[model samples]
Target: MMTEQYVTTSITPLESLNSLSPYEVDQLQDASQGGLFRLFRQCSLAVLNSGSELDSTKLVLDKYAKFDIKISQKHRSVQLELVNAPATAFVNGEIITGIREHLFSVLRDLLYVGTELDRRCSGLTESEATTNMVFHILRHAGAIRPHVKPDLVVCWGGHSINRIEYDYTKKVGYEMGLRGLNICTGCGPGAMKGPMKGATISHAKQRQKEGRYVGISEPGIIAAESPNPIVNELIIMPDIEKRLEAFVRLGHGIVVFPGGAGTAEEILYILGILLHEKNHSLPFPLVLTGPAGSEEYFETVDNFIRSTLGDDAASKYQIIVDDPHEVAEVMREGLEQVTRYRKATSESFHYNWQMHIPESFQQPFEPNHENMASLKLIKDQTDFELAANLRCALSGIVAGNVKEPGIRAIEEFGAFEICGEPAIMASMDKLLGSFVEQRRMKINYKEYQPCYRLKHDAEVVEEV
Candidate 1:
């Protein structure tokens, strides 16, 4: 049963900035079309709607039709006024402490990104400026620590996973936590929340008080994948590209669990970066693991990678199966190697300053009908370029699966048409079909209608 209660209140900062300059306050209060008010309202609603059972962004907004938030400048500081907010965020008429922090964290990042960073940082290309902007937003959120070694492991997986897979992720996280490694994830449910929950227990057992469970999300995703309560540090990037970049740059290593199109998109993003010739010698560890049943899933992924990007890209990551202890042991060993490499090269321990991410991957790819149809999924392009195009296709499928706009687009325009080489189209169709059959697409597991159509050449229509 769902609880029903509504409250309207004004909240002041707890640990965040209590005061802002007059100009800054005015900028926040500006509710005009080009102002920050819309961004602030959308993100604020997402925070208030945390722990919601509903995953559809449009559904969430429609349910809370009367919800509204306004920024007010007080004598000494600023306060946020909420109207008809979600009741679950409140306990005994007071908002939860962690949720409140997340709320303000959203405010902080949105404001900094919109006003200060954009105004100050100009004359930079799309990629360089975007990466620099992500760095600034993270640094302002106090997410980066210069003294910390390379121990943060970014875990990517679906929020809508099975109980067995969720438990497996928790077990892996527990093993990682026992070894004193921190966790970073997309900050939603299922696989994202399971690892943090397990790590919390292990952190308690080890008497580690400040075990960081960082959740990085974007505006388009936050409403669907609300920040799980375990997320102590939450940073909302401007878009999906920057958010993905933050994950790779801030963490020392990455661990991928069984997931859906979003997971596939993440995998492609990392592979694209690692495929860059300049990043060849970098000591970044990539591992794909799951329980025994998930072996076939990884095999599909491995085969797809080999078929698409060739053997060199496949060599960038290792696949481990059904061993939580070994996963942690291998991650720890990798981190040690990372530390040695960073020290020897005099690179920063907190961020991967040496890795080169092309503008193709850094820029946001709008998964609209035209953009989806225009993707070049051929083998003739460079390996990195092929990875980028594959990444875009996966991203589009992810959008159609959960994102409200993409869902509506699919409903109106029908399935997105993806044209590519015959072999590549066959490989993609097989992998995506496996994902759907495995129930990895959406949280609502009745039956999934694919949002894409694969075309090989002008004549061949491949099965999806």
Candidate 2:
């Protein structure tokens, strides 16, 4: 594996994180409890492995088993020494500037999370406090701009998607960019990269030199999906929940591309937030669009949402197909609504402080088998609460599909058993089956092995 190809080099920070306190430096170097050294090392390796096709975190880690990164504390600055790093990160024996920046971003975020965040976030259990944590983290990472209008459109989709769908994302991005809208994404490959890549050209054509290409990722998932090169501004959140929160809080609208479990998780997360009673008056745009080939994919998705979350949930988002220009037009219209709503309500352009996120959505859902099995699938709870639980289920499947820990867990425990109301289970099983059959579960997938089992539904064939 090229991931094991060794390289040894010493690199200094180019701009951000030039200097660090001695206390911070010492803590970063320590591998003991409360040390951020290992976290920093893995994240750096992931960034260095950018543009990789591999999505299995375990495979990536195993291939680069001996990869190592060390920090050298300086008199007024800090430096990183790499050993056994992926050769792809370097061109002509120098790390690419974007990769270097992403590398430093990994360091900045992990350090902030390990050292400052907990102390600052301590004693804050309220939902608003959790949202506040997201704001402060983004503020520290320079993601939230004070005077910027509602222009950032957060695009969500699967890393494993077809060429046509990917192109559609780019086209939509180009249209949006021509309209002077910025782009934000989960910051990985596939749909995430396409829009930003498209927007760059459009921005250049429009003489817009200053553009924000924001990519937000979390440590757990970053290893599998490294920051795409198109991302000029990268922020590493501590966990997936916060990362999702950052997207909704900062972006004016959302554009969803065709994706698998991870995409499903994102859809549910936003719907859950929008379905909240407090958010009924708020004007956040959510458009689920794909290329012509993705009609069945979106149909299944829409069916699942309607079957479970009901017609009201289905009504919250518009399904747009084949026309990227229309997608951008809807986004523009939605932003206008958002802008008007903000002006009338006196809300900040940068942060949606008024949007109410339930603690269930804010609290991180660890995707272990036990947790997956315990997910509430009954319709008795509020629509928003049900959406949150459904989000957790999809989230667990995503973990089993890619994240190293979740992969290992699935291998050890067999497929995660999903038992719930029979109707809901049947709908979920059918939706996931469609994803697998259409090869949405992963890129170039020959066949998908089930990482989760719908135990309550027998009509679906069980993978043994």
Candidate 3:
């Protein structure tokens, strides 16, 4: 077998991260249990590993096991020395411009979150604290713009989408960009990259020089979904929960393309928040759309929502198929409504402060085997609460599919057991099975195995 290529380089920040304290540099060099070394290395590697096809974090880490990064104070600023790093991040023996910016962004956020925000919000309640943390992170990253209109559109979908669906995402993004809307996504390839790619073209055509292509990620899944090359603004939230919260709070609207369990988790997350009675009067616009041939995808997603969260949850989003122009038109009009509502309510255009996100939604869900099995899938609670539990289930499945810890856990044990009310389990089974059949689970999907087993009545069915 051919040996893996590598690059050794020293790089400095392209922007504001021109300096770091000696203590901060030492913290990055620390590899102890309490240090930020592992987190910083993983995130930096993910940023450098852009455009990689491998989606498993374990596989990525294994493939680049020799990769190492060191930080030191140099010329009154921070300089990173990468040893055996991925060659893709460099061009002509130098790091790519965008990748360089993203690298410093990783350093900036990790240092700020680890050393600064971790101790600031001790007096607030859990939900308030979480939101406050998100706000602080975004503000620190310069993502929050005061007096800006509602123009940022958060796009949710899978990194493992087909070419047809991917092209459709670009088209939808083009239409939206023609009308001067910005794009935000998970910062990976496929659906996340498509809209940004398309928007860049249209932005050029419209001479919109300051278009925002925000990419939000966290430590757990960043390796699996590296920030795509098109992403101009990258934010690393503390975890998946905060990542999801940041999307809803920062964007005025959302458009979901065809995707897998991760996309389902996003859909359920927003739906659960909207289903809360306090947000019933809110004007957050959500649209689920795909190409014409991808109708079955939305149908399955819609049926799953109707079956599990009921019709009220289903009413929160509109599904549009095959028409990028109509999709953009609908979103433009919906955003107008959002603008008016924010004005009438005296809410900030940059953040959705008035939207009530349940504490369950805000709290992080650890996708361990026991946690996966204990999720309440029955209708014993309100629709929004059930949605939260179901969201956790899908989130666990996503972890099992791509995350390093979850994949390692599945290997140590077995497929995660998901026991729920029969109807709910049945619907979930069908939805996941469709994802499998469509090859949406992983990039290397031919060898895909079920990471979960659904318990229905007396029989347990393993999904594959």
Candidate 4:
């Protein structure tokens, strides 16, 4: 049985950006193609649809087919009027405070990104430009907390996890919270939501009221994975690349759980950065963990990484199985090391400004059929470049699995063709097959279909 609820409410702005210039307000109110109204509408809908069980972006949009949001400027400030909104976002006919704040946050970030990209600040290069853009977005959302030592741990995993794994995430979160650490994640359900939910109880038990639960997402994914209610601070990046960059840059350390293609993309992104010759000495802690039943999952991930990127790449992170206390203890020690390293290196505590991210990782990856088929997935290239290509391959699989545009593209065309070295393709095929068998692809779909086909041709070898 599914819960069906609906509500309509008009909310006024709160502490941030309540005041907008008449021109700015008018621009937001404009729904024309050239205006910011469409962006605002899509994000607003996602915020209001928080806590939904739906994981398909297209499904969520279709369920609330009649939903609409209108922006109006008042003499004192701005107001949002929602029609046919999801009732789950309300209590007693009033919008949930957190959801309301998130709605406005969507407004705030969309405007800032629009303005910043328009100005093209300082004519920065691709890497510098991406870093600056991430900084600006975090600053706009007030996510950067100065004077606070590196303690924020970013958790990444699938939103459609099993009961035991979900509970294991919470246990890890409880341990982390008991140690007085904060949590950051993609802000959807399952593993993302589990840690925060567990931490809340532990925080209350420890009488710690200032714990932070930050959820970072982007426009393309927000609808599919609606911000869980526990996410007190929400920031929507402009795209997936920026969102992933935000996670690595803002977080002191990262803990990866068992997940599908999306999680693989995240692992590859971080490993690619760590594999860079310049970053070999950086003290960034990466851990892959889960409960006892999840041992096989981590083994598969380890095997895939070792077979493709080699043992040196695998040395960057540690795998701790079925022990939440050890996970938390190691994370605390790792974060303290991160703090000391930052001070020793004279790096900023809030952001990793010293980390070197190559242009290949910073630039956006468009997962079209041709681009997917053209990836250089062989081990002959440098480790960092191989990681980059592998990241793109996983990213394309992610798009095909749940993203609306990717799903639509598959429907219109056909399965995306992924042609690479025979060895690489075979390993990728095995990993993807494992994800499917474990049911990590989609939450509610009856049967999952392959959105991509692996093509191994000898002629492609010469081109590479």
Candidate 5:
């Protein structure tokens, strides 16, 4: 299946930003700090590597270290010149059509965020500005369909999963698609690709013309989790926090599949927001589901939440096991309630404007060693606050596992140190240990390394 090691092609826009101004092209040519050249090159490479089986950002870069992309000011238009690109992205000698569209999409989103959105977000408070940036980015990407009803379901799970679990995800997606639900995910392989793949078959049978398979991602992680082929619309949020916000604001319901640290990070992020007293009346339907033999996986997650966040936090989401049809039915019914409530409240059907996401959740969390150690993971804070810290802890682990910079951080320092009270640390230890034991951390690798270690004082002892 391997072709040439590299190929060069000139690419123009398909349905996005047909032309960039001279200033924009100049900025892209600049390699300085504020310039877009490096970001543009990295993202464009990710798009070209969309269909690749590789998931590690480090390996992907090392395999194609010579890969490069440049912006050229063609006559009356702007186009990209890719150099030494991946061979799988080509048919015969030319670039694939879908990859061409995706390449333009990468350019479109990066440019919008770098210039237009950046300029527009200058003078507002941090909270107001974040929401505005999310709205504008999605609007520019044409992700929001004002005329559509509540049908989009955001699927979250691990990129590294067993065949049984992956097949189970597709079955659930097929059932949901037959019921007229669109799909969204973190935009990678495994569970993310499975649902869209399943939904495409049913959508074709049902003749659903506008079945959207939106893939939301950010710059820091796109290299690690390349956008899957099924994503019709791809968005690159400014950071992880905004990416998480986009999921809650854009999706009518959420489907949680079995995953590892990143999946736990997502679960904690959503629970943190939904636990906000201000969001007590929110009608968001959160469902955790999996195939047969996955009972222990869900039990660990359920127990961890119940032990830390208590019954109130556990009540926000239902655990549905083994039955794809029932999962889809429950989600369908929940979305119906969402529709009725939104209609009654006169809220926008396209986005969840009424949902209250706290500023703590809204702010981006840097996963550096200093920031990771500074997280308050104890139970002294509110449930939402503890959830936020737990989310950050898992986020750091995700970074150290697959992200290029985080791997560098670990190689330089050591495994991240996470400490908390005895009870909370025990729960964290159990959850993370299960993830590693289940081999949910990485796929096709020889072994999974411990990117993080739990630190407890003499007064608080626990296994990590």
Candidate 6:
């Protein structure tokens, strides 16, 4: 590792989260069991550490172990006192304006979700309550714009991607931007940042000053994949499930690019929701596209989906290759369908309230070793339910790859054991093996190791 550099500074917010109540300030500083201090520090460090090559949360925290942040309530507004922050976030000893904004955004969301969300979600079923909570979080962050047309497109892919694949994502995003569509992503680097970076130029060319590059992230994965520089609007949900829900509700359509485990998890999440019988006729646009050289990546993913979820689930999304203009055209046409469907159903344009998200998809999945082993990955259940379980399985693999807790768990206990139906296990093994071969697991692919192993009770297949 190179010699580390640090910066110390105080930053004041530009607008929102300028002030906080005395109780909120206390909670933020409280380092106790229910305190937000640890969460706040980790998230703040993530935004300040943007553009770093570190993709492992444990590694980032280890390097920045001395970093600390405090909320200082000034007479006029709130100021953040930073100690030993990453030097890259500053130039000539002044914090970058965008990084400063993101620091406050972290404070805003953490405070709102920790202190206010529970009371607002009272007396509702688990599913309704979660959806309501998501709405409140987005509205609080000013991400929901009423009376606007359906133009937000959620881009899901891996932060760990190759140069050619990353460039393909930018091309797709540029195409979408020229057509007046906004972008939403996981707020990380690689595939997530490429789209936003490409869209900025196109938006400027079109003179669309209000182009929204919304990034939705959660506390767990934020450190592993820091918020990219081009993300103007960042919303940090309480957990990964809520973060996924925020994307489906806030965006009109979705464009999937090449990715690894995390990307597969996102695909399963959306496909599971779309496969619901109630959502059979819903006109949500789902397109999977990449460059000409990325055919192997999509083929592996498609084969896995077909072998496991069957043909009906495979029919939910269309795959496109090497054609940015065509991808944009397809998204535009699909958005038109989305607009017509929402209007006919009398649903809000900003949020998709009419789409049915089952409780399985809404529930937060904890990807511990036990949960990973217990996932019902057999085909005995509904296709959507199977998708949900497989989503969880892939989620565990993602956690083990980068997230701090998961990384530490693997260090102590070794690789996680995933046992299930033999054929599904073989398909998963083949798909994940392809990720390893393609270098999609982490940024430092040469040093990467498998974090999970596959097994089954029945006779093992000789080939995948």
TM-score of each: 0.96, 0.96, 0.98, 0.96, 0.97, 0.97
Worst 10 residues of 4 by lDDT: 455-464
Question: What tens digits encode model 5's per-residue C-alpha lDDT throughout 204-296?
Answer: 889998888999998778887888888989889888999999999999999999999999999999999999998899899999999999999
Error of 6 at 421 (Å): 0.5
Model 3 TM-score is: 0.98
Global lDDT of each model?
A: 0.89, 0.88, 0.93, 0.88, 0.88, 0.91
Give the per-residue lDDT digits (tens) of candidate 3, residues 1-464: 32548999899887788898888888888899989999999999999999999999999999999999998776777788999999888777889999999998998899999899869899999899999999999999999999988999999999999899999999999999999999999999999999999999999999999999999999999999999999999999989999999999999999999999999999999999999999989998899999989989899999999998999999999999999999899899999999999899899999999989999998899999999999999988999999999999999999999999999999999999999888888899899999998999998866779999999664785565
What is the Cα-based lDDT of residue 29 in candidate 3?
85
TM-score winner, 2 or 5: 5
Candidate 1 residue pairs that clash: none
Ten-residue stretch with the least lDDT total in model 1? 455-464
Clashing pairs in 2: none
lDDT of 2: 0.88
- Clash count in backbone of candidate 3: 0
Q: After superposing candidate 4, which stretches have Cα over 4 Å from the reference?
A: 1-4, 30-34, 117-120, 458-464
Q: Write the per-residue lDDT of candidate 6 for residues 1-464, one digit (tens) a residue.
A: 42549988888888887778998999899998779999999999999999988999999999999999988887947988999999989888889999988998899999999999999999999999999999999999999999998999999998988899899899999999999999999999999999998899899999999999999999999999999999999999999999999999999999999999999999999999999999999999999999998888889999999999989988999999999999999999999999998899899999998889999988888878888878898989999999999999999999999999899998999887787898899899999888888888899857568888887884333321
Winning candidate number (lDDT): 3
lDDT of model 6 at residue 49?
97
TM-score of 1: 0.96
lDDT of 5 at 396: 92
Shift of residue 115 alpha carbon in model 2, Å: 1.1
